[model samples]
Target: MTPADPARRRLLLAGACLAAWPLAASAARAPQRVRDSRALMGTRLDVAAQGPDAEALQRAIDAAFARMTALSALMSHYAPASQVSAIGLAAGLQPVEVAPELMQVLHMARDVARRTDGAFDPTVGALGLWHFDAPQSSIPTASEIRRRISSVDWRHLVLDERRQTAYLTERGMRLDLGGIAKLSILQSGLDTLQAHGVGTALVNGGGDVVACSQRGDAPWRVGIRDPRAPQRLLATLEVRSGFVASSGDYERFFVQDGRRWHHVLDPRTGRPTEGVRGITLVADSLEAVNGLGTAGMVLGARAGRELLRRGEGVEALIASADGGLWMTDRLRARLVPVAG
Candidate 1:
């Protein structure tokens, strides 16, 4: 035998002992494919899983979806009775006690805001002056924007670690977790799946994606949509175990006088961010990827590259406003270009 074979084999065996089960044994048990889909977090949630028992996997999927639904109730921006809504309703009056899960999200949102230096601020909710939705598509007068924009500041959101509460310092301040919460909610669903003994799975909410383990002989395949082309994919990724989060200016925007007014607004200006049009971040953990895409869009391609370099395991594909495409070296090597 080779000198390192025994040690390598021992290490692999140890890994199996620590894990839930060995991948080979899982496949040996004759795993079946299970999939389900539904609307979640204001987008479609598509989940596919693999396990030995179809019935067990299906039940696990349902539980996972249920967990996502529960988490969504905590973060929804439009839900009047949501916990976040309560925080906004009590702004300047009192700190609202929130669930631990919500507290975790708030902590994450604030952390991202701090790290990005307001490039992707959740407080941009205060600039809720533009409506990209049909029948209500409109923008506010410059005077109105200037007034509300003053209240848009992430530092204004206070999280009380001792009391597990959230408070907004300004009377009309709002907290929109749209940039950060969907991935967490999807992650909650994936956690539920693993807790239920299903390990090989993929869950995608609109564009944010997370997948684990292996599917037969190959890893999970995900298509990265082109920001410039709605019908074409720029590339496809083969993920082993990772989180994917994407942000785009084209998703909800209106063109006026040759200017694109998108929902992803810059907190500093109360207007859509300029320079980068879209960003897709892939990382080993949700924490590494969440909010990064939006931050990259605001920071532009160069600064965004600097931001990605700060993270240990993050890779990205950035489509700039000037129609130039940039991809991290690691991703570029593995990224398969879609044939035209």
Candidate 2:
């Protein structure tokens, strides 16, 4: 999907109860919040904040954009000279040390990869054949896929916490943080805002949203887009605190020969996942939810449900390719089911 599509937009909701400020009054005095959205990290970032704090908010937004740009440069497999690209060059041969931030993200990516059994792998960078952003991207051959698949190994990624470095054991191995870095950046932005004493803000980075504040009256309202009908709303979540993130194949895919090729590549087979079309997750932390959504999608309906059941403070909604929908009990509590 193109960036203009609403389905590609990530929405964050934050709500808080402030004893000093009433909800209606704060809503009235709501800082003059402005939004600036641009293509960053291969996705859109929507930032909004209120009060005379506009200047601080703008600074915070600029800081976030800058950080995300750096992250994209470090993690993008498309860039031939990026840190990730360097790792690819040394894959299966030597270990490449990475920056501290990159190392942290890589550690999280590796954990998700292991916990999800490679479903949410950062090593899918081996599948360099398909281009989701291209106008006419085509699928690669089975043999080509297999050859590259051999290089997709998350286990080869070695992290030294004491040294704060990341190493790729295989010669052609690469790291693609597309699954989690954006959320990390968003969380960083939120932390920045909070540090600046900006209690109210929303960071919506391409459908991975984190909202929080010790102020505000009612819960933050977040809209979930209907996967089958992008123009319509599926349900509205009232988030008093915490975050909500969603991943859907429909956001980035191409239709060729009646087959759909999405961006969420499976590390095991180096191909876009089938079965589940989309997955939405609600949790208190981005670190927890970052790779979980992709893992849930790759696990299909049953396994996805099982994963959610085992996770605490996490709720999920899954949409299948066959048009069937499933929701965890926690998610059901938050959503008002639409009549069939």
- Per-model TM-score on C-alpha atoms: 0.89, 0.87
- Over 1-340, each residue of candidate 2 has an lDDT whose tens digit, in order, gives 3336452233433211101111323435544554567777766676655446678778876776676677778777778878878877876666677888778788889888888888788887778787877775778899999888987878888888887666777766667777787788777777766676666666776677777645544445677766656555687776656778888887778888888789888777778887887888889876668889888888887888888788777888888888888887768887754344
- What is the C-alpha local distance difference test score of candidate 1? 0.79
For candidate 1, write residues 1-340 as lDDT tens digits. Answer: 2335342122101100101111333234555767687877766777777777899999999999999998898888779899999998898999999999999999999999999998888877777778977778798999999999988889999999999999999899988899999889888888899898887887877678887875453466677877766456677777778787878876677787887788888788887788887888889898899888888888888999899889878998888888898888998998777688
The C-alpha stretches of model 1 lying farther than 4 A from their native spots are 1-30, 214-217, 255-259
Give the whole-model CA lDDT for all candidates, comma-separated: 0.79, 0.72
Lowest summed lDDT over 10 consecutive residues: which window, candidate 2? 15-24
lDDT of 1 at 303: 97
Give all candidate RMSDs, comma-separated. Answer: 7.9, 6.2
